[model samples]
Target: MHILRELWTKEIEEPDVKSSYEYVLNLRERLDDTLKIAREKLEKARGRQKHYYDRMAKRRKISVGEKVLVLLPTDSNKLLMHWKGPFEIVTTVGINGYRINMGGKEKTFHANLLKGYIARDQDTSQATTDERPPTSSCAMPAASVTVVEDLEGEHFNDSDCEALPELGGWGSEETVNDLKYGDELTLDQRRQLEERAIMYSSIFSDRPGTVST
Candidate 1:
């Protein structure tokens, strides 16, 4: 507008369509000025935003195999149970990015969305023991047990075992007198007694001179 003031006062000639370059140049200059101001304002806004973000931002160094917790939004309106992991890092994906094992599925996450896991002393000890490779001398070749299936008769049928008594306790006076033992018994003793009861159930139920209760 300042540069065009002299031209505006002296323009007494008939408007020639072929001589409109000067008018177009003036409009172009104004448009460029407006664009420059807009760009400056945008840059300043960006700088302020960057400053705010940088105040709380931190450089998190995470490695593969390290455990981390991921930040996740929850269904509840209350801010509870928001973070979900302790998932192991499987691979490093680009800058500030990692691939983690989430219950056997792999998920990619940014560093800002994760936090490092501080394992307890007991947990560290347990993990060390679990992760330690066995020595050559300690690693014995696994023995393959051959299953001998007797197809000749229907022996060792799981369906038959289901029909057998669970044998919780001595159900009758006859059973109590026959065993002649207290209710309190060790696991092995109880199992043996149960097996005996089952065998007796088969024998006495089928034969004579035997009581069934």
Candidate 2:
């Protein structure tokens, strides 16, 4: 306004006015034109920017059936395994501003709380990943034995033979009594059982340090 007034006054003071008056009017017209163009271009740029952001936000959004955890100021809670649940994506709700979810019947949490959400497929072993001791009992190996005759085949007095029973008492009372003075040998008889146990453990070992699902 000041510049416009000064130019006007200068034009008025001029005795010959046509040229100066036209100059000032032209200058003001140029200012209006520039302003109009600038405003139009600015509005167009703003609309384009809004559209781009809208598309970007949509691309980043998670929908129902997707498992996602809500972001928080600190991931410390997540690190500690303090966070809960593998809540499934139940629904979506938002208008591009601060949207939220109505969640599922089980967990009716807000969309902002989506950080608590985790992909069901990936997050699966997350909750139950830790392990505990197995609950089954293992079979025991059995033993075997063989007998060896005494060096002396003839009957002997009490001083020569002690009343020692046969190997495992595996014989009848009369049989054991008859062989009381005989020698016996014993051996372990669980080859098949031992091999089965070893094979069973190795097959289920699942490549060391890996927890079975």
Question: What's the TM-score of each model vs. the native?
Answer: 0.42, 0.29
Candidate 1 TM-score, C-alpha based = 0.42
> Model 1: per-residue lDDT, tens digit, 173-198?
34322554457988889888778876
Q: Could you say which candidate leads in TM-score?
A: 1
lDDT of 2 by residue, 117-213 (tens): 4344655576466443233343323233544365554543454323433344323323211222213422333444455555665443323355589
Error of 2 at 184 (Å): 68
Show the colliding residue pairs in model 2.
67-118, 67-119, 68-117, 69-114, 69-115, 69-117, 70-114, 70-115, 70-116
Lowest-scoring 10 consecutive residues by lDDT in candidate 2?
Answer: 173-182
